[model samples]
Target: MRRDEFRKAFFDASDRVHTYAVWMIRNREDARDIAQEAFLRLWQRCETVATQSARAWLLRTVHRLCVDRIRQRTRRQEVSLSMLPIDSFVDADATTDWSPDGDLRGDVIRAVVALSPEDRAVVVLREVMGMSYGDMGEVLAQPVSTVKVRLHRARKRLRCRLEPLCEKRSVR
Candidate 1:
């Protein structure tokens, strides 16, 4: 791709790529690094990657980078919520239908963070980022059917985990 085309692609997809990284790993600094690395990789391969597919390419790259980061965190035995600031768990502009109540929001964030990385990625991509199953499948390297199943299972798991909290709030 030419410089102007690359610039347009970067401007168009950079925020979405960064947001995906943040939601995947729940660490702003690491997310920024991951976004930068993904963009750098895109730049390296700009000759091959089409401008129309740049966002998807960036997302796929970000997903792999996040998986690697998560694996490294696991290997180091340092995957703890306390390692990141409370605010980093959920973005302020995220489309998650979180209530204004901080406690409930915290509970919801905890439930999401507790999910396995794959499940969390599906949830963020579908629910938060509003990507279609086909797009998600491309980013995740899964079949559309598999993406649907994963998303369904992830939502069910989240509902099961948060049901009690909702019930408690309703009872009060």
Candidate 2:
């Protein structure tokens, strides 16, 4: 594609790409950086990336970058418990809907965060990105059957982890 057309495609896909990155990373600044890097890679290969598949390519690129980032962080010494940032739900902020009252939502977020990176990515792609199994398989470079199995296992684990919260809500 021409430079102008490539730029237009990048701009058009930016918002969803950023949102997906943010959901995967859960940090605004890091997400922005990841999205920018993905776009840069796309720009470098603009000739090869078909317009129709741009979104899928971008999504997959961002997902790979996130996985790499997590792996790099893991290789480094992890943050100590004492060094971890405080949960700010102490007072309502637009950042999260998780209040003391919405403990279930908070718990679910924790569970998701605790999940393995691949499992978490599959769950986010399916649930948050609303991608079909075939689309997810394309983005993830896995078979459709593998994508379905990963999504099913992820959902089952999430549901099992959140079951107590559901029961508590029902009791209330």
Candidate 3:
């Protein structure tokens, strides 16, 4: 594809990419910055990345940028809740009534957030982005086998952490 075409592709995917970033990092402003930087990187490397899968390339770019930003920020000091912009979603009313235990949803979010970045990426890509393993592998630049292994481990950990919450709902 020509440079213009590549630019167009990046623009087309920008919204989804931004949403993915927000979902992964849980910061709207940071997500916007990540998406812009990813597209900028694509523009800079347009020639080399011309024939690569656009979706995968954009995702990988955004993911790498987010990771890098996280690492750089961590080097400065300890990470704490104060670092995250207060998200309005947390104040929103509960979405599900099925969790009679009264905090199952919050528990699930905490379990997910507790995961390491790599494991969290796997879970988010598979579950939230709805990417197939092959596409996820492309985005993650990992073999499908490795992606599957990571996904399995992530899900196992999530299940272990969430089981009590689920069981509590049943008991209630």
Q: List the residue pairs that clash in candidate 1.
A: none
Query: Could you give candidate 1's per-residue lDDT for residues 1-172 as a string of tens digits?
Result: 7656988899999889998898788887889999999999999999898878889999999999999999999999995563454466556788476644546787777788779999999998987789999999999999999999999999999999999988998888
Worst 10 residues of 1 by lDDT: 80-89
Q: Show model 1 residue runs off by greater than 4 Å.
A: 80-103
List the candidate numbers ranked by TM-score, top first: 1, 2, 3
True-structure lDDT of candidate 2:
0.78
- For 14-100, candidate 3 gives per-residue lDDT tens digits of 877986787667676777899988888877887787555776899998899888877877798645453343232244564544242
Best by lDDT: 1
lDDT of 1: 0.87
Better of 1 and 2 by lDDT: 1
Number of the top TM-score candidate: 1
Model 3 TM-score on a 0 to 1 scale: 0.80
User: Residue 79 deviation, candidate 2, in Å?
Assistant: 2.9
Q: What is the lDDT of residue 154 in candidate 3?
A: 97
Candidate 3 residue 41 C-alpha distance from true site, Å: 0.8
